[model samples]
Target: MSGENQAKGNAQSSKKANCCQLTVDEVGLLKLKLTILAVLCVILGAFLVAFQVLSFMRVENAETERMLIEQKNRNDDLTKENTKLKTGLQETERMLIEQKNRNDDLTNEITKLKNELQGGKCADGWQYFDGSCYHFSTDTKNWTESRDACVTMGGHLVIINSQQELDFLNARREMGDGRSQRDFHWIGLTDAEEEGEWRWVDNTPLTDPKLVQPKHTVLTFVSAQYNSHSTQFHWFWGINQPDNYKEWGPQDCAMIFAGKLYDETCRSLKRICETKSCMAGV
Candidate 1:
């Protein structure tokens, strides 16, 4: 009986030993499964991190694009502004040049006028057209005599159409408080043999014009003097006094108090010596 009891205890010990071994095996398997789970979690976490990084990169790229676009727009705007400023500067330069040219022209004109205004007494009359001086004598002579005198002086008896034209002939006569009126002026109009029928030596018809008409109208008269003159027929003659002003001499014709021609009577009348250039413009 003691032997059988000893064998039973041994078997029990063996069974206990086997059960501990199984427990150890089970613990090892559990540890292996936990390790696997940890590894998987690390892999998934790495994938998430990579995905987040990619997403951030995409966002950064989009922002960069937007910034690039904005920069391009700003560059375009600046370029346009620069071009506009350049164009404006060019226009300003052009205007300045034009203004300078105008100023120069005005200065030249002023100088010329100052010089012309500083001439002699008869120089003022000559300046009427060609900047010449014409002197009209207050002496009386017959028409033929006056014409011959004008020829002798390289001039001729005066004709009138406009006051400026008359200025060429009469030299802007103002009568000077009626002192010059006591003297006479030689005019181009003459009756000669006819009454009220006047003719010019130039063969131009006798016409008395008013001033400054419209497009399709008759010749107009404009007086250069300050006084208001009666709108009367003005006659003129070309200078032949060696191309000088028409002066009168008594030897040209017979003397007369009054005759067939009133306007023709060069008995101390206003006269002029004119050039063709002066006649064409006015």
Candidate 2:
């Protein structure tokens, strides 16, 4: 009975040992499975993080592209404006140059006209219009002598038809010194030849335009009047009675210097010849 009991106990001990070994093996297998699961989870998480990083990088790249495009548009706008400004500046410079040229031309024209009217010794330059040289007097003589002198010179005395004609003669009075009948003056008109006929030495009839009262027919304050018969005088000069250089010539003849019809004088009056002239235009 003792042997049998020992055998039974041994057998039970063997069973227990086998069960423990199985448990340990099972536990180790479970631990290995758990470690593999943890590793898988870590790998999945890393993949998700990497995917998110890639997505953010893509978005950043898109935003960068947008900024670049905007910057490019702004640059293009500035370039266009700069071109427009350059074109405007060129146009203004051209206009300024054109105006300067026009001004130069006008200045030249004025200078030329002045030299033309300055009386000179061409003698032909002294020709009278309205048949008179009253604006300028060459010398003094009696009214009778003046008429005769004008006749001989081929021109009659100056007859003032209007105030304008008178003014033209008066403006040039700077040429002479003697103006008074104390400096006896010469005149084309007189009761002398035809009394009140008032005929020019040229024999042209004289009509009083302004009709200064008590006026005569061939009234020549200065040398030369539109004569019915003749029309020119040279070598003969007349004077204003008072030697007045104003437009109201009433000059027997007068002295004129600065401008046209520049008659310079004769202490001794003589008869000469001349043809009537036009004021620059007549």
Candidate 3:
């Protein structure tokens, strides 16, 4: 009976020891699970922080790119504007040069005209116009004698070359006031060679018949042969002039009286003599 009691006590003690060991194992497993959970939480927090930082970096890069694009656009605009300004400046300079050239040409033309006018001079006792010299006679003579006298003086009877010359002669005669009864003068024209055909002293043919028309139509007496004239040939005629009247016996010569011409006898009359410059001579 004592042996049985001892064995039962021993079994009870062994069972108690086994239960304490089980309790210790359960505590250690629980600690291990808690440690693993902590480690997973730390890893999740670190991942979240890294994601946020990466997002900020992306945003900064995008903004930098946008600024660079704007700067490039501004640079392009400035370049275009500079090119336009350069072109405008070039055009302005060209226009100024062209205007200066035109002014220079005008100045040269004016100087040339002045020289031409100043160079046209006549000898003493002779009036000058367009390079010709004219002399008025103080003595009277027949047509032949007058012509001879003009030749001796190195000139000839006045031959009308232009309407301006005619006007000048008429004005001169009016100013002379040296005639009585009639201001008749012997010119260098005659029809004595051919009866009806008139000739100048220089032997040029009298073309333009309208030159001797009536005084009313005389103003329209520009040459029919010439379309335009810088100089003109004309005639001044009296009333019923050059009639070839038998009453005025053998009137084949022409004479001027008071700027009007008439067929007359080669009697004594005042005359005009004309000479040309060496450069203007035939």
The best candidate by lDDT is: 3
Ranking by lDDT: 3, 1, 2
For candidate 3, lDDT tens digit of each residue in 1-282?
999999999999999999999999999998888888888788888888888888888898889889889998998998898899989989999998998999999999998875555355545666766667777776889888988888887889888766677777777766644654367778888888887677878887766553455323323344564333222434466656676665756677777776667778877888888888644532
What lDDT does candidate 2 reach at residue 266?
A: 27
lDDT string, candidate 1, 1-282, tens digits: 999999999999999999999999999999999999999999999999999999999999999999999999999999999999999999999999999999999999998876655443233334344433344555546566767676666555554456465553333444342534334455554545453344566656555533211222222356444124333533222211111112542222111111111222234444444333233332
lDDT, model 2, position 162? 55
Model 2, span 126-241: residue lDDT tens: 53434343333465465556666665655556654455554454443323454322222233333334433444455556554332223223334354543542333221222212
Best by TM-score: 3
* TM, every model: 0.36, 0.36, 0.47
* lDDT (Cα atoms) of all candidates against the true structure: 0.53, 0.50, 0.74
Q: Candidate 3: which stretches are off by over 4 Å?
A: 1-120, 177-181, 214-235, 278-282
Better of 1 and 2 by lDDT: 1
RMSD per prediction, one decimal?
A: 13.3, 13.0, 12.6
